[model samples]
Target: MWRCPLGLLLLLLLTGHVALGAQKGRGRRELAPGLHLRGIRDAGGRYCQEQDLCCRGRADDCALPYLGTICYCDLFCNRTVSDCCPDFWDFCLGVPPPFPPIQGCMHGGRIYPVLGTYWDNCNRWWQAGNHSAFWGMTLDEGIRYRLGTIRPSSSVMNMHEIYTVLNPGEVLPTAFEASEKWPNLIHEPLDQGNCAGSWAFSTAAVASDRVSIHSLGHMTPILSPQNLLSCNTHHQQGCRGGRLDGAWWFLRRRGVVSDHCYPFSGRERDKAGPAPPCMMHSRATGRGKRQATARCPNGHVNNNNIYQVTPAYRLGSNDTEIMKELMENGPVQALMEVHEDFFLYKGGIYSHTPVNLGRPERYRRHGTHSVKITGWGEETRPDGRKLKYWTAANSWGPAWGERGHFRIVRGVNECDIESFVLGVWGRVGMEDMGHH
Candidate 1:
């Protein structure tokens, strides 16, 4: 009796769910055109029996009790559904006068004429919860939360022209990893949590690595990002986000103490409840806890141990030039644009891919992010095409991408990674502290 559009009616007939749609007139509550009501239960009663719902081998949220699962087909159970659900093809695939269910025709609540990709356990679980909508976040929210935080004046975009020397046939090594050369110098990846403090973290981390490498393992200090996040508020906002150049400027003037002295909570003043006054005289000094006071960099005349970064410069646009900078210095800070698909990246070199969200304009939503460029390598494809990638260290923790690091398409500046690269020199005079 319900008049569905011609397309829906045809789809229902083709899928053999026409009988299900026809049950709407018989006192059956019609959720959607083809969706029918099997039964209903009391408010507190179980929605769907344990054995009734789809398990799909792994005990994920599919088994959870949902109001829809109790009465509707398991194919339409949770708020989101697709062919990935268990027994989807067995019972719900072309229901009456069953026809051979098309394999790979549907996935994660989406229908594809051809099988470009299929759903798996990881994608199913990730898609169910971790998206812009599920987290109550929109592209605007992400842009405001991440990219909008940094002040416009702090952008070092035009610094690229400083190092435009062409590396003509420099004959470089096959692959290079900064950590391999500077063992124990590059610190492990740190997590920034929900805050947008990647700017501060990447700056602080780059400074730490450069200092250790520059001093030839003499001044191997894990500089404190908390110092930059909590104390450096001149032209930047903590947590809410700030520019990396401002952080580097803060480092150049008001050196950061060791993490042992002032640990990093990763949150800035906004999210970290309240900001504590910069500690002047702390027991933990640069030279262990024994020293009463260590020399603050640039003669800050402050009590806390201070470190300074030399004036930051830009890196070349080409991979060869960037590699040369990495070999000479240490890790450099890079700001890149992040797309929606980037969140689901598990491993391998990442490239921007279109997400089929029933909308063509969804790709416009992007957020700016920062990372440390540590190394580079090349991988040959089966078709003889070469995929060169830049090794980037992210602040999202090691469990994220390739152990807290990800490789992006190199040379082409995928996601504008090669667009803005900045490097700084560590302050000298920390070689042999007490051994000399």
Candidate 2:
């Protein structure tokens, strides 16, 4: 008679699979307590299905007596012990095993588990087939959360067509940086955190540099991105995402306060929450000018003056035009498609690598992002190949690539960065620079 031990019966009852023989199927017959024999196609030797063994409970009889030791087909067998049958996953779970028989990965002369990951310098190295170990989230999540610049609208695109032609005879230098050329004028890059507000951050950074340069370092004020994020509501989705044209439009019309006055508050809000209310407002001060109508959000600094920018102009895709614009006028904003691998950028002339292209479409995501193109240069490689690159400032903070800056392949419109370049003039009158 088929009889289960008291301990085995208690375990089966706890697992809620006590009625073992009740399941009538392909020649199912109880062999010993929880152990049952079910007819399966004869592949070769006795496997999980051949023994009619697919255990759901934690019982001693949930295993089949195999060569010398027992092999378990129970659900919890592989939790602490690795004594699962060869066909346990296939027969019991109707799915393939987590990995092939050859487990663990080989890297740097050491064997790592299937999902092992490590950091080499700034870049993260992960075992093959372990995508989540690198970025903590999937590519889709990165695109949705990390980036924010939306594709330019038709009007913004048409603006690029109306490029400000520069003098072709102007002899440009091999390399130049706005910070080096105009020290203390260009503001360092600011961290946007996880909020997808690069639109506001980039615009604020470019405007800050331009204003400082235009005023001859007299009004070197770091503008507030939070002012743009909360205030620029016209066709703008503050933290979630926004367009460059809308950002520039807000800068030209509504204007923003200095970082000391308004400051950035996007980091404080929930990642997916609505933008905070506009803390600072302005009123027309005659002759196309604006004055702050409210006190500084930060009470310490009594200066609540509004800073405005003239209508932004577009630069040609030609590297020379961009260089000239950046050299003459402070920093310029460039829109680029940020791919998955960009988040891993450390320091180098960055180019979208095809390493992750073989991944599924969901893992190879890209999103639009705006950055401040500060300068450009060329470097001769060991192979005598001269590679040109654009020195741009990202809004991911100082800890990121090259102390808040990065270099990308300059020519060939790499990543479409050179496709749409924009420059703006700060509306700094004599009175605006009177303090210095």
TM-score of 1: 0.64
Which stretches of candidate 1 lie above 4 Å from their native place?
Answer: 1-155, 164-169, 266-277, 280-304, 356-363, 430-436
**C-alpha local distance difference test of each model:** 0.57, 0.70
TM-score of each: 0.64, 0.70
Determine which window of 10 residues in candidate 2 has minimal summed lDDT: 35-44
Question: Per-residue CA lDDT of candidate 1, range 7-81, in tens?
Answer: 231122111212222222212232333221211111111223323554434333343222232133344443323
Number of the predicted model whose TM-score against the real structure is largest: 2
In terms of lDDT, model 2 sits at 0.70
Error of 2 at 377 (Å): 1.0
